[model samples]
Target: MSMIKKRRMIEIQQLQDDSEKQNVTRFILEALPQWFGILEAREEYITESVNKMFFCAYDQDRPIGFLYLKETGKDTIELFVMGVLQEFHRKGIGRALFYRAKRAAREKGYSFIQVKTVKMGIYEEYDRTNQFYQSLGFKEFQVFPMLWGESNPCQIYVMTL
Candidate 1:
């Protein structure tokens, strides 16, 4: 049987402790496999204790989505990773986490926010992800054929804040 989604009040904020890092790691492992199943060589960011800009979306204190941001340059922040639990998809949790990160970046005077993902249409899940970010005003910045190797061309999106 299909389950119903509950109307939720989600709070977005920076991840503040090792416990939250664990929570986000669990969430990503659970949520992203559907999209990134082929890429087993997971990056160190999620596996290690988060010592970077990390944020999460919580529903009554339970984490539903998480995002990590890093200052890639003097005036730009790169969205290193983001994931929303499968069951919580399409419920605005990801958007909440993204905007919270964007707000924080903007407040810190970052000139741009960028995200790199596997080129959109190559994967169904990432296609939706691209659409979501485009809806948030992030436009195509560049596509690097060798960034993640030929199979996983990296598409970078950017929004000028």
Candidate 2:
């Protein structure tokens, strides 16, 4: 069988219930400490996701990845937080969630979808993250050297919808 056909199926769906969203966010983030090791930030993401647009990628009933979108401007939506279990990395689950995010933004009439991550070159794990966002057509918008702390300079990327 081809590699694609050999892989298990994954489904992406928007989560509506507040409790489910928080639970899934916590579950996925806990499995990805390399990206979400900061307890305060992780907790904030779990809590705030209830109000933002949220999507979860599941293998059967188990959540393997998730993405959250928050309206940052009248015409801009930010990819507020996202995580995929390490085992599922580069397996198209993140890309699938991203396409869903782009479709949601375009359907909502947003002009831009933005994402922020630790600047590339500062960390190995985040460098792959930067690459992933760039590969998905997001371009560098700006940088906030102290936003996440001097050790983790924040790089912002935006994709026009």
Against the true structure, whose lDDT is highest? 2
| Predicted structure 2, TM vs. truth | 0.95
Q: Provide the global lDDT of candidate 2 against the true structure.
A: 0.93
Q: Compared to the true structure, candidate 1 yields what TM-score?
A: 0.86
Tens-digit lDDT track for model 1 on 1-161? 99999666878878778667866766676556776464444445556536777887788877777888888899998888787888888888888888888888999999999998889778787799889888889999999989988888999999998
Report, for all candidates in order, the number of backbone clashes. 0, 0
Candidate with maximal TM-score = 2
The segments of candidate 1 whose C-alpha lies over 4 angstroms from its true place after superposition are: 1-6, 38-40
Determine which window of 10 residues in candidate 2 has minimal summed lDDT: 1-10
